[model samples]
Target: MRPPSRSSLILFAAVLLAGCASTSSTQTTPGSVPMTQDSTPLVGTDWRLVSAPGTRAGATLSGAGAATLRFEADRFSMRGPCNRHTGAWSRSGDQLRFGGEGGAVAGTKMLCPPEIMARETALLAAMQQPLTMEFEGPFLRLVAGDGSAWRFDSRDLPPAEGRERIVQVAGQRVPCTGAAPMLCLQIRTQPGAAWQAHYGEIEGFDWQVGVEYVIRVREYTVQDPPADGSSLRWVLEEVLERSP
Candidate 1:
């Protein structure tokens, strides 16, 4: 047997440490670690956000500015771009009922970029819709139908036109702008109508840039219908921004 020496003892300790580190690294690798694929769908499983729309927002999970949703069975907790919110939800097929019990989570007062803030508000409002969930691995994507088949970005929004359509509010031929995405009607109170409602949006698909935009409006009937043929006008609203 080799006689014990201070140098030898130090060498033995180093070798043992090296072995332990190698084993730990190997176990952490994707394949070497034993992983049992969960056959069950993710609806009932508690899932935290693993990826996000942009890094400008910072890492997902564990931050107020971070957008996260921890979903487990029928309950969920969310952290919006500005506030922390959580609520209970129920799912049937693609339809989702998102409000049962939840409140804002208290956290630090950190402000995000304007665009990020806008997107976060829109996303939170959208959660109110009955949702359809698509499961891919550990991710659950929820989608809502706001009657928009396409999406657009802020840059994509066309310049507002000066031309206007002559429509009677109280009863007047007011100048107005009418376009596919934008609709504006100027009212002249003197002529009985003097208010203009301008609405516009653009839509397209550019995944590399991450843009989803839509604008819509819903119309209803008053006790008296306008001279115009239509009694109701519906509009949807959405805006997408390029990831910077």
Candidate 2:
């Protein structure tokens, strides 16, 4: 049997830990929070970091934010270096908030690289207050009170009209270094070729993790772009085959 995904393990652990905490606590648990209209976009969603302003994305030592934030029911967990930090969360209007022990996550610690350790500390501190939220399709950006924003996507991305090619897409998305810690597709040009992480968009195609695909794509040179941006663009022309 295949192993469970990181998300499944984190979720299972979160659920088990949350249940234990609730039963063991003597303090009054907050009453059932009424569903808020503003939270519809976030609830039951798993957001992976696409970029962050303060801490560098793809930084092995760069710290400043959680790579993944999952909202399940009224509770959530943010994946960190030392631990998976779990907390209570709520949204109202333009703000989303977290609840924790004494304004910090409660957990045993592990030693990591000094820089990573420090970033983890800063990341937890940043979450102590409320953050504003924005969304565009599969992408979601959460901005802290200090304007240190974290951008995430749980996929817009037009078709290209240049040279066409056939590629095979893997069944899973891997963590890649793009502008940030990216959840990207693994694709290869030849049948026996090693898969390479694709950080660009596949225009006009809806690609899902755990689904393998053979596709036709058009490639073109990107016009003037930022120094760090991709020089070439690939747009989806046709999906030749899909395997569940």
Candidate 3:
């Protein structure tokens, strides 16, 4: 058998750990959550994430904040949510069992703002209940009975218009540097290749980087940007580049 993906492990751990701290004051209403009709076990079908009410602590959500869940006979894979997570699963009556503590999930270590992290923490804590799943049209509704819900479907993104070369910025690259810990890289947008950006916590502060590459130095400044005020300034202590 093949090994499980890292994201899957993390998702499993996060979900499990989220359940560890159960003293949060939030009380769940006592009632039976409606389950989807027993057409077939959703464990072998592909489902896409439509909406995630709660967020995570240290990560960036991709696109409109949606993800995909591909459920195998004994395992599953979740794509989107800015990361891919998968692992084994089991079902007992109405209770679903995602791979317990043994599974692993690889995720971005980058931290999010404190407030956002709190929300994510709450969501994780909310995942402790006997979750419920129902079919909402083409989407699957995943509810943890703690007021948190997620939607999924099966749809692939459209392909790019044409083939293009990936250009490297010669002098436009900014080395992210400062006391704050972040894998920051500032690169000026080039022709054809518009800057794609994603930035969350900076100097332990909340900063938004739209398109990941298109640098908006002004926005960083209003929120108390680097004291030096260098638009082209960035620091990436850890960076992984894929070869073409």
How high is each candidate's TM-score?
Answer: 0.34, 0.42, 0.41
lDDT of 2: 0.58
Give me candidate 3's TM-score against the actual structure. Answer: 0.41
TM-score of model 2 vs. true structure: 0.42
Per lDDT, the best of the predicted structures is: 2
Ranking by TM-score: 2, 3, 1
- By TM-score, the better pick of 1 and 3 is 3
What are the lDDT scores of the predictions, listed in order?
0.35, 0.58, 0.39
Candidate 1 per-residue C-alpha lDDT over 1-244 given as tens digits, one digit per residue, 9 for 90 to 100:
1122210101112111010011111112111211234233444333444333433332222232335555564456555554555555554434445553332222333334344465565665566555555554444556567631111111112343232121212111234444333333322212222355533211221222222111112233434645543444432221112222
Return whichever of 1 and 2 wins on TM-score: 2
lDDT by residue (124-184, candidate 3, tens digit) is: 3444444566665556676786657765564444553322222222222234545553454
By TM-score, the best candidate is 2
All models, RMSD in angstroms: 24.1, 14.7, 14.1
What TM-score, to 2 decimals, does candidate 1 have? 0.34
